[model samples]
Structures are given as structure tokens and as C-alpha cells.
Target: MNIRNDQYTIILLLLFFPSLGISQVEFFGYMETEYDWMEVKESTYAFGYNKLRLDYESFPAEEVSIRGNINFQTYHGQTIWEAFDFLPFDSLNINGEAVHSMPISFLDSIYMDNLYINAAFPRFDVTLGRQPISLGTGYAWNPLDIFNQKELVDPTYEQPGVHAVRLEYYINEKCIVDFILSPDTNFTQPSGMIQVKSNVASFDYSVNVARKNHLYPFWEDEDTVSTHRETSFIGGSFTGEISEYGMWGEALWSLSSNNSAGDVSYGLDHTFNNGLYVMLEGYHNSLGAEKDGLYDFHYLNYFSGETKSLMQNYLFSLLSKQINEYVSCSVFIFGNLDDNSFMYAPQLSWEILQDVSLSAFTAFSSGDADSEFGIQNQSFRVRMRAYF
Candidate 1:
């Protein structure tokens, strides 16, 4: 382990030592690799990336719990700087004669520093610290959500971490209530956001209201840009599912006041009896305007810059078959409705041992926007995962 890894390990031990007497401990992690041979540039599919995480969960007492997580990523070339601006240095060079240099930035720290605490009561459960929160169910397009993912929506983890409190209560055998409250600042704002969700009869619904306070820095000046209400979104969602085919559909709407912006979305998901799963989702966000000019939906700003929104659409299909107790094969396809781009992945997975599995996967994408494929993008990745 390096100095950074060792330091974090020590911290983890110290934090959880006091509760070890009655606590339960668990470990988990996974590894993924991608070979990108579909770039239009000189870059090969070998952007070389790997991520590892160590998680510690302790249930010291029946009502209280604690969890800690550390995530590590190693990437080569522009993939690290371009895709994620977490690092301050523009580039990294490793040569035979030069010492290694690294960038220091706030986001760089977030890459590995994450923690949380959970407390459970008879009627409600509460969690405090940095965690993920997603309000709407629209995969690539969550108009009602100020947070969301893009591209392969089903496979993308779009939500950013927030310091918040979450509450869940079992209203009855068929009903439950869920809510969240978070502090928002330039680094973290949103004095608080709350949602009330309930499931009754054959339908489920939720209503949420929230405000976000943000600051945008001029890319070059650390102190030049003024801090203002970057954006605030308030929204609600409604969903329905049928018992027979287990098909479900949902609609979401978010009203924004800062710039007179708002968005709407609709989605449907279904699973067939033959181990086939399919989903379709769409969204329209009124973030741009025009006269004879054209207005466009921009999912990138409200959520994150990583997302690109137009007449966005997403489709997910998965078919899995179990060859035996520990082996299976799955075929998945993800496509964008507004664009002619899609990814097809067929994977065969096997259990290497308890809590350990190996998988061989091949994927290819077709679309002009995706650099992984040509006019039609193509790439392959294989992953190994272990969990407990």
C-alpha cells in the first residue's frame, strides 16, 4: 500500500474500533477493464482504467450502524483529465528521468474520501453523511431530478454525493414513506431537499420540493466568478405497475424558477417471463429558447456537465439465462432514441468462489456522438467482481 492508502486504512481502523465489540464487519469491491478500439482519433480503446473500493459496515447495536468506503481509480492519458476535472494538473507524464507529479484539487479528495452513518428506529431509519440521492426514475433523462446520468443510462452512475439525512418509514404492509434533507453550498448547498413517497394499491407516487444554492467559478479564475443560485428544481413523480407482466411506467416534472427553466419526462420498464427485460425513457427540458431559432433540451447543466441532452431517449434490454447454479449469460443492448447510437454487450459470468465472480464481456456502440465507435462506435471490456 502507498502512503495515501495506508493513511486511510489507519483512519478506517480508528473510526470503527470503538464499535467493534458488538458490530458486524463486511468487505466488498469490484474491478473493470475496457479496451476501446473505436476512437476516431489516434487513441486506441486502451484508455486503461481501473477502480477499486474497500467498504466497511458495522452494526454495533440493533438500532445503530456505521459505514466507511474508499474508492481508488487509476487511469491513463486524457481520459482522467477530460472526462473528470477532479485533478488540477492538465496532464501526467511518466518518463524514465522525471519524478511523478500530481494535481491537487477538491475533487481529487472526493475521489477517495467518503463516509456515512445510519441509525434505525422502530418507525423510521435515518442516515447522515456523504451519500447518493436520486429523486426520479428516468434513466438518462431525469427532468424532475436535479441529478441524473446519461448515455447508457442504465449503466451510468450519474448522481453526485451529498451530505444529507434520509428517512424511511413503513406506513403499512403496502405503503411506505421516504424523504431526504441536504445542505447545499458552492461545494455543497441546497439548505435541504425533501420528498414524500408512498406506495398504495397498484400505484406509487412521490412529491418533492427543493432549492439549490451554487457558485460557478470562471474556469481560469478561482476567485473571479460570483456565487448565485445556479439553479433550483422542484418536482413530483407518479408511477404505476401491473402485477401480471410486471410492467411499469412513470412520469416526472420539475419546475425551475431561477431562469424560468423546467423539464418533463416519461419512462416505461418491463420484464418478461422468459428472462427478458426492456426499458424506454424520454425527457424534454426547457433550458434554451429561440424565435425562428431552435430551442433545445439541455440535461447537462441541471445534472452535471457529463450529460448531454437533446431530444434524449434510452432503451435497455437484458436477457439472462442460468446454465446451472453458478453460471449464466446475459445479453444487453442500450440505445439512444434521439440519436442513432447504441451499445450491445453479451456477457458470460461464472462464480469463481463464494462472493467472487468472473465475467467476459464484449461491447460495441453505434452512434455519431460516441467516440468509442466510429460513425458506429465499437469497444470491449471484461470485468471481475467480488462482494460480501
Candidate 2:
């Protein structure tokens, strides 16, 4: 069998027989159903999906542990016409005949999101396999996170894990260090990083250095081509509190063979005595475009892994209030200061029952036609989640 099939089979066996030969095991996860309405120009699209996730962890020995997570999702809604636009010509043909039809709404998939093993030593810890890694003080833009790219628009959302091996060591009560290595399919190309963390007084600080391959699109001979180049990055972040207010900042510098880019982010947050919280943040990206229309294409090519904007400057603000023990509401605003475009998102969440939550959110954008948030007029979403 192929490697993919083998991986699935192993996950299935683990799920069915989690307690076999294991000293201790734990299983937990959540199920979620969501409905979304999106407006692109004058066209409106309605979509929905149901997702179920299961997480398992076992400790077979004092020093050895294993963890795995599986996710299953089924999607239903309007036909995905935009997918056909990007499909290759060969993909549209079957048995020497061109398939001109697309499925309206019928797809389901199951996959393993995390499969990892951990070992604890006297002075250090080691983890190998697919896992989640994030490092930075920036709430919206995490330039220092070299392993997993995050969705800046919704910073609290969970991101997909990456395959890598990580090693962590504690030097003292306030000092720690980490090393990570991730090998690509080619095996010859590997990406990795080293980080040092420490705490002094009331401030937490971290420094990171990494080398990774970056893919960029370039125009050559009237055609767009993608090229991979090795880039070196060094970054640092710090978080501290001034009186009753929290403050944080992060900066990263990337050096390439021909060019260099830098990004910096800073933020301040405070919570009132009445349970009201507010945050304000600013980010500057040296690699982003200074003008608006130069990066208009990003609107059409936006995805989860990419940055939300290609403009240089951004301002983000958030306000949240807790109504009671089980209900909360928040509003967030992301503005492209360079282009004078902005997006506002408001959300409400409630815990209606034990282990169950309901949330509703909507996003509205306004600006010129070619501006960042103006491409998609508005969007609404409602989700229900149950954890066990």
C-alpha cells in the first residue's frame, strides 16, 4: 500500500484500540457545524459544513508518550465554480473525454491532523511528527512563527499542524531554549529554527533565528513563474505589563540573496474593572506595497496561509465585554492605513448548555473597489460546537 494509505490505516487502528499496551490514555475532541453567507460583488453564496475532530494521547512509559488527532468534515452548499478556473487542463479530462460538469454540493474528507511522539529526558524534551508550533508576541501578525503560518484576521482560530521534530531544554527556572527541524518531500531541503526564551522582572522575552525556503511569484517572458529561494530570518519579541496595562512587541528581519524585508508589530491591551477589555495594535511590513492598486491581485488570491494584506501599514483594534459567566461579545477592526480601507467584524458567543457553545459573527468591509477589504462586500457566519 501507499504511504498515505498506510498512515490512515495506522490512525484507524489507534483510534479503535487506543488503550492497547498503554499505561494511560485520554480521548477528547469536538464537533462543529457552521453556516456561512458570503457576498462577492453582486453574487451571494451560501455554504455550510459539519466537522468532527477526535484527539487521542497515550503514555506507554514514563518517558515515552504518543498523541494523535483526526478530523472529518463534510461540506455542502453552492457549486464551487472558482475551482475550475484554477484546475489544469489534464484534470478536466477523464478517459480521453473532457468532463465539463462540476458537483454542486457533495464532498467529505477524513484526515489526521496530528500524529506525534514525545520523549522526556532528564534535562530536555523531544517531540517528533506532525505538531503545532507558534512563537511570537504579535497578536495579529506573527512574523517570527516560521513553522506554522497563522490566519491574522482571526488570530484565535486553530491552525493546521506541521511535520517536524522539536527539542526543548530548560536552562533554569526562567530560561528555556528550543530547536526544530522539518524536512520537505525532497529530503534534501530542510527548514529549521532555534529559539531562546527568558523572563526577567515582569517582562518575557524571546529570540529566534531560522533558515527556510520561500516561494515567490515573478513575471518572466510574459508568464508568471514561481521560484524558491533560501532566506535567513532573525526575530525577537517581548511582553510586559506597565501598571495595569499589558504591552507587547515583535520584530523580524528576513535576508535573502538579493533582497531583505522586515516587519514589526506592537500592541497594548487593558481590561477594566467591569469586565470590559480593549486592545490596539499596529504593524508595519517592509515587504508590502506602499500603494493600493499594486497589490490588488491579493484579493483574488487570498487564502488562509497568506497575510491578510499586502499593504505596508495596518492598524487593528478590538473591544470585548463579558455579559455573564456564559456569554461574551466582541468587535474587531482591521484597517489598511496605507489604502484607507478597513474591515469590521462583530461576534457574539454563548454557552447555552454544558459542553456546547453557539456563536454568530459578521464581517463588513468598505473602501474603493480595488482596495483590500472592498473586494468582498460582507460575510456572515453562525457556528455551533459541542465538546466531549
Candidate 3:
């Protein structure tokens, strides 16, 4: 079908059948605007964007429900040096300039971020359509999540949805199982996973096995190419609390026909009586580099979306406190132990009104030029958001 036809069909369905067996409906969303300034070496940059989202949920029946979200965004920016150091290219051009820039105009897209439906039964539930799926216990690194991969630096951000069908079954009061099927290329080559979760004593745990497809860097003699490959993954995670401290751990092993890799991550967090909160996390990837001075053009092209860092070992720490009823402050540090590079980000937020907030943040890096967090020198951001 054509794109225009698909859009028309969706709009018709939304407008013509507003009360198709629906018992209740709810609507909500948010609007946000942000401005950023960045300094990389001798170059300075500016960026700004505004985003609007609309979300709706409806209960069609006692056993059925529907949910969806639509997003609209407009942005304008110019960058003299690249804002992201890990991207495949150096700088992007917009209008005959060696800088990243987007004019202030509406994007030519009415994005449907999520559209899904669910049906529940006594012992099992079924979900179908484009939806978000994530599975893991670790806060910083989620090695066990096979679908909807997340960026560790901004773990709380919302992820895009994927088309899939999922089935969940309850075995008993303490155990449950899930099965997911996601199709690729006309539903012939399907990928999926099986997960079993249980509560043992005071800890909650899950084990998963899956078959998935990914893109990898392939070398043929002197030439390099990005090739598609299939892999099998096995992983598990556990979360528990000891006294006032919370702890979580996750591990994953990936096996291909020719190579195998693994990763592990763990975290600990605590909240004091005075409302001070702190967290620490550690991560290790067997497929990552063990030494410094390894990132180059080829490395950037191969690992842009696959990994966050080239180093094998990493540590993350966060400290946050609520100064008053309307203000809060936080600091986060990310360290690459193998290269001795670190990034520090500090932020302050104020609740301007009941449904509005303002925030300011700054990020700085310390390391040599060749190290991971050193390419992008510093950046600052100010954002305002209103929830409706």
C-alpha cells in the first residue's frame, strides 16, 4: 500500500469509530522545548527544538484495551563541530555549510510512536500491534533486553515501538512465562524470545533465551562492509533489596556461528533519611576493546549504534537531592576505567508551576584527545516542559 493510503485509513478509523464498543477513554500528553549550547575544541554550536506529543487510551471491553501516541516536532540548529563524537561522520551539512543545521520548520511527518491493543484472560494475555517491549532489571545497562535497545547514558528516556505479537502466561502465583514473535521481511524470517520469571524468597529473577538478527562489521581481505548476521542469546537478571539498599544484576551471552561474546552489569542504590539518593553501577563487555587509542573512522562506523563505548570496563555513579519542594539537583559521573576517561554531568530543575518545569544541565569531559569521552569538550542545555 502507498503511504498516503495508509495514513488516510488510520485517520478514517480514528474519526469514524470513536465509540466502537469503547467503555471509557482518556487523553493526555506533554509539550517540551529545549535549547543547547556546545563547545568542541575551538568550535561553538547552538541547537533548539520543540516537541509535542498526544496520547490516548481506551477500554473497549472488560478484556480488551487500546492505546496510542502521536508526536510532532520542529527544530533548528547549527553546529561548527560534530555534537556527537560516536557518530559515523564528522559534521553534517544543511544548506551549503560545513555545519549541522535544520531550519525552523515543521517536520514532514506525523509520527505514530505507539499503537497497540491488548486482550486479557484468566491465566494468559495476548498483545498485538506496534508496541514497546523491554526486559531487564539493571538500571544503567540492560544486557538481558533483546528488543528495544536503550542508551545507557539516558536510560529513562522513552523508546520507539516495534511491530510484534506477544503472549504471556501465568504458571502460578510466583512464576510466569512470556513469548514474543517479531517478523522481519514479510513475516518469513521471524525472531522471538522466551522468558521465564519467578519470585524466589525476597528476590525477583528472570531467565530468557532468544534468536535475533543484527548488523556487524565484516572484513573481506582489505575491504570492510556491514553485513547481517543471526545470533542466539541467553541471559538472566535479578533484583533484590538489603536493608535500605537496593541491588540488581544482569548478564548476557551471545553466540554466533563464528564468534561468541558476553557482558555483565550490576548496580547498587540507597536513599537516606534526609532525602539524599545515591547509586553506583559497573559494567564489563567482552566484545569491547581492552586498551585505549583504538577508536578511528572504521571503529565509529561499526559501533555507532551497537555500543556506547569502546572500552571494556565502565563505572557510573549518580547523586541527587531535593533542595526544596520546587527545586532539585543531581550529578552523574561516567568513567571508562580502561582509558582513564570520565564525563561529569550536573543538573538543576525547578518546578515553575503546577504543570510546568524548567531545567538546566552541563556536561564536561576529562581525558586525552584519543580517549572515549574527550572528543566532545563540553555542552550545556536548558529545557522547559509543560504537561497536560
lDDT of 2 at 332: 91
Give the per-residue Cα lDDT of candidate 1 at 131.
63
* Clash number by candidate, in order: 10, 0, 0
Worst 10 residues of 2 by lDDT: 82-91
Q: What global local distance difference test value does model 3 have?
A: 0.75
TM-scores, all candidates, are 0.68, 0.85, 0.84
lDDT of 2 by residue, 73-103 (tens): 8887863645332222213555577766544
User: Candidate 3: which stretches are off by over 4 Å?
Assistant: 1-24, 79-108, 185-188, 215-226, 256-258, 293-298, 301-304
Q: Write model 3 residue lDDT over 210-310, tens digit each, in one string.
A: 87765443532135343545768788889999896999998877766454666789999999999999999999876566674354433543245454346
TM-score of 3: 0.84
Candidate with the larger lDDT of 1 and 2: 2
| Candidate 2 wrongly placed segments (more than 4 Å) | 1-21, 79-106, 215-226, 293-308
Candidate 2 structure lDDT = 0.76
Candidate 1 ranges beyond 4 A from true positions: 1-42, 76-113, 138-161, 169-177, 185-188, 213-232, 249-252, 256-265, 288-327, 367-376
Cα RMSD, each candidate: 7.6, 5.2, 4.8
TM-score order of candidates, top first: 2, 3, 1
